[model samples]
Target: MSDSPENDSIDYGNLMHDALRLLIRNVLTDVSENGLPGDHHFFITFDTNHPDARLADWLNDRYPGEMTVVVQHWFENLDVGDDGFSITLNFGDQPEPLFIPWDSLVTFVDPSVEFGLRFEHHSDDDDDHDPDPENDEIPEAPMEENAEDDTPHEAEVVSLDAFRK
Candidate 1:
């Protein structure tokens, strides 16, 4: 673990993080082209005020910290790209569109498949950022649920501490 030139040459962790972000983009791209399969749905949590995050002024005002949205049903205009994705979801019976960059995503989870990814963001506004609590920004009211769903929604929390040094 010397501070030699070879050891300090490049940042491997950053490369891995970038690669995972690509994976997320790829997954979203695929889901966009060929509709989501099975009981699969996504719970995406991201920083609302991130520079790359795009949404209405009211949205930013409402959710200034962390905001989570369900991509189960009633999502429209899902545009996925290399940098990020934008989609329209219902917010209290109104169509709300949100564009979020990969770097701003705090967590992506598919509870049905028990698959999830948690990201630790290094942002300029980390003064009061509290991403430790799962579903920290969940809406107070219940969102539109599946018509055939008898089971209640459940969240599977996963830790990313092991990946951090």
Candidate 2:
């Protein structure tokens, strides 16, 4: 067998990203089918500028870049699809529906269990800067207080730096 680097090169980064996204999808699907079990909740951060991300005009205006949503107490009509998920959440007592694509996701965290996954943001137009492991810290999103409790939750994020080259 010929040992060519090109022939043996596999896109592990993309593969891992896809697998983690599938995990998110599966979790969302389970939540949609059977509701969040135990004290489990999710802190989902996504790109608001993504083409497939749908939110109210006011929300878009308010959070033009990225937004983190807590899927805990006040959520409804959760629908999980192959490519994405849709759910209704309240904003100042006004319920609004949002559709967030899996590809648009930046991070997924379940602070109750201290489990988290952070994804690298790739832009087609961004070709100048290379991936920097040092700058890979997950960005904090504005979190709403849980209705049932006043205590704050912090996610223990898992960095994907070691797997990168």
Candidate 3:
């Protein structure tokens, strides 16, 4: 692809990445408002140290700066606002409060659909100041049991006569 005079300065690659992140955010926001329907579930992972992140002191003590939470049957009090959303979930055995801004979200995964998205935070210059994974203590990815896990039968081999012919 040749860069024209006007197109030379635009970085389309990064722009598309940003767009994809936005799309994921929109999906989450919708889910937050309308509630998850049927078997759909989300694994939301976010940077806990990001300026906009809010968490109970105890949760911070245990999780430090990053955590991945499952949005499932247990979550309650889901309040989504313009800047962020607040939800109450059982942390350990006690209910804990958390507030997470959209910008703080680093990754989102839907195990049912085998889909996910990752985002990076950047400064005004669009240069990423990498998150201190050590300082923030990136949490281990949570394991999700999808339909395949429960139904462990092998695929039945049915001869495809149409293709063979």
Candidate 4:
């Protein structure tokens, strides 16, 4: 057999994926400590059905495939770590906290700086889509309690279509 780079050796896509993921973790860490500065905000889209994703019961019914969240004005208990991040936001006059692992996240966008990233978290097949089930190895619990306070707040739903043009 001839020695070649494509001789069933390295997975370049997987390597690049991991490197790009690190960028997200770094950005999150900064936000967790210093908080978002100026007009900077994030439009994060993630797989709602991901094993590590913990959202309110109602959200699953609404967004079965994926859900995008705007991290701008109204959010609480923002925590970012090695594995993932968790934050609480108000929806329909109630607190909805969600835990989303890095592996679960499909997109991360910052409109202010025109920075965006899209990760392939799912397979092409309509069926047999196997997401990385990190939960099987590590047990997890909801990060924040359901706050009864009906704080009226809203998160902007940014459309990427505008940027495309």
Candidate 5:
């Protein structure tokens, strides 16, 4: 057998994915603790099934496995502690609370500047976790939320169509 270090592989891709998640979490933590400074908003999508996820009964019912949250206008009580973040978001004219730990997060998208990151599913076992029961191919959640608060979801959903020009 040939001796090659490449044969004993390292998953640099997964490592990078984990690092990106931490970076996203840090940004969210900063924004939550201190108001997002001039023209900064985020689009965060996460798996609802990961053990650390928290959502309203209705939201959990609608999106049992995953959901995307807009960190723009109308969000309140933005608090980020050691484990995760807790914020109040409006759902169909009614405000609901949500809490999401970093681990539950499966993807993060910052449409503000044409950037996005997708994470491995719970099944990937990047860090020793059992596979989630939910189906992995379920469609992604919508990019926006229906809420009365004006938190600036706009920054998270600008026109990429401009790039086509």
Candidate 6:
């Protein structure tokens, strides 16, 4: 047998990434069929510049690189598919449609349950470059309960690094 670089062997990283993205898809699919259960809400962050991502021109211009969206309180027409999902969200009472591909997701969080996932984008050319720390940060979910409650709950984010060997 010929020797090969570990990275060239079984790619657990990509496997895990795909699995997590599927999890998000499944969750969204459920929510699309039946509205968010209890106080469960999501804070989804995605790369606005991703080629597959579709958003309003003004939104792209305002957010530039990345934007975080709240999937609670006032979203409409949530449609989940095998590869991505689309939904209409309100921005200052202006409803705009957004199509976010699963691959463009940077982070997904449900602070009510204190659960989250962070995805790291890897590319052949990115092998030598360090990951952007900013992308690692999961945005805090919007208040899903009484505004008087100021307690903060930390999310248990599942990072692939923990499973890497």
Deviation from native of the Cα of residue 24 in model 4, angstroms: 0.8
Query: Model 2, 155: alpha-carbon shift in Å?
Result: 16
Q: Cα RMSD to native, each candidate? A: 10.6, 9.7, 13.5, 12.1, 10.4, 10.2
lDDT of 6 by residue, 7-89 (tens): 45776666777788888999999999999999888888777777889999998877777788988899999999876999999
* Predicted candidate 5 versus true structure: per-residue lDDT over 67-113, tens digit per residue: 88877777999887767788898877899998887666645665566
Candidate 1 residue spans exceeding 4 A from truth: 1-7, 122-165
Show model 6 residue runs off by greater than 4 Å. 1-8, 122-136, 139-165
TM-score of each: 0.69, 0.75, 0.62, 0.69, 0.64, 0.74
Q: Candidate 4, 144: how far from true, in Å?
A: 27
Candidate numbers sorted by lDDT from highest down: 2, 6, 1, 4, 5, 3
The global Cα lDDT (0 to 1) of model 1 is 0.68
How many pairs in model 6 have backbone atoms within 3 A of each other, for residues 3 or more apart or on separate chains, i.e. clashes? 0
Score candidate 2 by TM-score against the native.
Answer: 0.75
lDDT of 2: 0.73
- Residue pairs with backbone overlap in model 3: none
The regions of model 5 sitting more than 4 angstroms off are: 1-14, 122-165
Better of 4 and 6 by TM-score: 6
Using TM-score, give the best candidate's number: 2
**lDDT for each residue of candidate 3 in 59-148, tens digit (9 for 90 to 100):** 665566567888877888887776667889886778988898766666666666645554544434534433343232223354222111
Best by lDDT: 2
lDDT of 4: 0.65
Query: Whole-model Cα lDDT per candidate?
Result: 0.68, 0.73, 0.60, 0.65, 0.61, 0.72
